[model samples]
Target: MVFMGIDIGSTTSKGVLMNEEQAILAQHLVHAGIGTSGPAAVKKELLAAAGLQDEDIDYTVVTGYGRRTYAEADSQVSELSCHAKGSAFLFPDVRMVIDIGGQDAKVIRLDSHGRMTDFVMNDKCAAGTGRFLEVMAGILQMDVSELEQEAAKATQTLRISSTCTVFAESEVISQLAAGAEIPALVKGICGSVASRTAGLVRRMGVEEKVCMSGGVANNGAVRRAMEEELGTEILYSPLAQFAGALGAALYAMEKAGKEKEHE
Candidate 1:
């Protein structure tokens, strides 16, 4: 049977297709997310990639911030649950997960059986999120993707005192005007985000074999800074951004199997 999962996040949408054996058939990511064309775009591209149509999918599950509004899903799941499942699937020994998305950051702890034990989220502010980095990169007149390369060249790390996005932006500007090196400032920006996220991780209690999910996990500079702040290696996959979608697809597969058994 064919199963599908879609994660409609704040700034991106991800989709995954799988078969009865749980083998991934296709995966797609769209830059636009909920309330935009992201969800529809992911569905179309994912189906086309797998050489299948919507009706061919035996089950469809949705997760993420926009899951409730997505009418095409057969069911909806919470991002927290989905992330836990996805991270465990990717790293079977993972005991902790840190997901930094566009607008928020979350730290989740899992039991030995891969069940979620505790989680802490920073949904109230934009600091320490992908949006925060994007804003900082913009002020530096550079693309967000260049942050890692720039940060790598830093000779020293400047400390950004403000944890608020607006205030941090002002701090960056002030430092730039004062002849601060851009690379050092970039490293500092990443360090600031790491420090804030580390606080959340500490609140939930750090565990070994920590894995990182979400778009920010793709940022090498931020990941390095996070590893240093937490004093542990953060494991991540190239498919990190799709973890939520993959987890939802796994749920779809399970649901499909159960329905067939009942029939």
Candidate 2:
């Protein structure tokens, strides 16, 4: 039987389909617009990718910021639990997970068995999040993807002292007005994000074998800066964005098994 998981994040929606053996069959991710249309968008895409129909799915679990609002899921799970479970599945040695999404950031501490033991989250502000980077990129008149390339070209890193997004934007503007090199400014922005995230990681106490999950994990500059701040190597995967969905899929598989046992 096929089980499914959908992660409706603030900025994107992701879906994963898995078989009884918990092997991934297909996955889908899409930008979420302002409203609640994300889950529906990814559901159609994921089902098509897996060559299956909605009726073919035996179980479903929904996760992420919009989980409770999703009507199609048989149940819902916390993104924290999902991230921990997903990180463990991908990196068995991972004892910590740093998930920086569009509008928020989270650091999850996991046990050796992959269970979430503790977590710290920053949802009150957009600072140090993917949104913060996007805003900086906009101020720089550059694309989000260009931040890494620009930082790579920097000969020396500049410091951005503000942690508030608005203040940081003001700093960027002032630096630009002063004719500061764009590459150095980009590196500064990345470093500020890393500093903020590293503080969160330190809250739960740093652990070896840290894995990064979420869209921000794809940013090389931020990753490198974070590694430097934390003084530890980070493990990342191309599937970083799908970690929550994968974890939900794993949960769906277990739910399916419980149903079968009852039958």
Candidate 3:
């Protein structure tokens, strides 16, 4: 049977389809574009991925910042739960999950079975989120994908004084003029974000076997920075961007199977 999961975030939407055995049949990521268009667009892409329409889906679940947008979902779950579920699948022993999205970041502590125990989230600021990195990359006349690599090469410690993206860019410029190496400046930015996220994770008493998910998780700099701050290697989900969707889909499968068994 075809089970689907959809994660509609501020900047992107991801969808995934899995079979009864939990094999991923297809996955797709699309820009959110405008308003609820992200989920709507993801729905279209999901249909295209499976070569079938919405009705063909045996079950559908939605999660993410815009989870509420998919009112027709079989269920709408918190991103923390979805992240934990997804992380556990990727790293069966993961007890900590850090997910950095465009507008928000989350640190979820999970039990041995991957169920969430507690979590903290940062949604009020862009300091350490994907949006901050993207905005800073733009100001530096560079691509967001290239930002992490540059940040990873710092030879000296560069301090980023501003938590705000706008102010950070101005600080970066000032540092650049002061003979701060490009790598140092880049590292500073990554370090700033890593520090912010690490603070929250530390407060929760994070454990090893950590897994990170989200589009930001794709950034090598960000991952390394997080690792340095945590002093451990973080596990990666093959489908980082689609973790929320994959979790939702997996949950949908369980729900569907339970319903079938009862009938």
Candidate 4:
């Protein structure tokens, strides 16, 4: 049987398909635009990409901030749970998961068996999330992907003291007006984001085998800064961005199995 998971996030939508054995078959990610339309569109795209029709799926699970709006899902799960589950599947020994998506960040603690034990989330603002980086990128006239590379070239360290997105943008503007080096300024921005994320991780209490997931985990500069601040080697999967979706797929598989057992 085929199982599917969909994550409708604030800034992106992701989908994953799993076979009866819970092995991933295909996964897809796309920018989440206005409302529920983005995830609905992504779900169709993933079904097409996997060469399967909606009828082929045995169960469908939905997750993330917009989970409730997805009328087609057989069930809905929390992003926090899905993230921890996905991180555990990728990194078997992972005791911690730090997920930074478009508008919020999460720190999840896991037990030895990969079950979520505790978690803390920062959903109040965009300061420590991908949106923050995008704002900084706009100020520097650089693409979000270029921020990490530019920060990597830094020869001097600069500190971005503001945790508020508005203030931080103003800070970047002021630095740019003063003819500050772009690379150093970018490094500072990455550092600031890392610091904010690290604070959340600290609140959850660090453990061995730390793993990072979500869109921000794709940024090399932010990952490096997080590693330094947390004083641990972090594990990342190429599947980071799709972790929540993958977790949802796994849950679908589990639910299907239980139904079969009862039958």
In terms of lDDT, the best-performing candidate is 1
Write down the TM-score of every candidate.
0.97, 0.96, 0.92, 0.96
TM-score for candidate 3, residues paired by index: 0.92
lDDT of 4: 0.89
* Arranged by lDDT, best first: 1, 2, 4, 3
Query: In model 3, where is the ten-residue run with the lowest total lDDT?
Result: 32-41
User: 43 in model 1: Cα distance from truth in Å?
Assistant: 0.9
Candidate 1 residues lying further than 4 Å off, grouped into runs, are none
Q: What lDDT score is found at residue 117 in candidate 2? A: 86
lDDT of 4 by residue, 82-172 (tens): 9988889888899999999988999999999999989999859889999999999988889898998999999996889537999999998
Model 3: CA > 4 A from native: 33-36, 261-263
Please write out the lDDT profile of model 1 over residues 80-135, one tens digit for every residue.
99999989989999999999998899999999999999999995998999899999
Each candidate's number of clashing pairs is: 0, 0, 0, 0
Residue 236 of model 4, lDDT score? 83
Residue pairs clashing in model 1 are: none
Write the number of the candidate with greater TM-score, choosing between 2 and 3. 2
Q: Model 3 over residues 180-223: C-alpha lDDT tens digits?
A: 78878777787778888888889888798888899988887778
lDDT of each: 0.92, 0.90, 0.83, 0.89
lDDT of 2 by residue, 111-189 (tens): 8888888999985998999999999999999988789999999998889964799998998899989999999999999
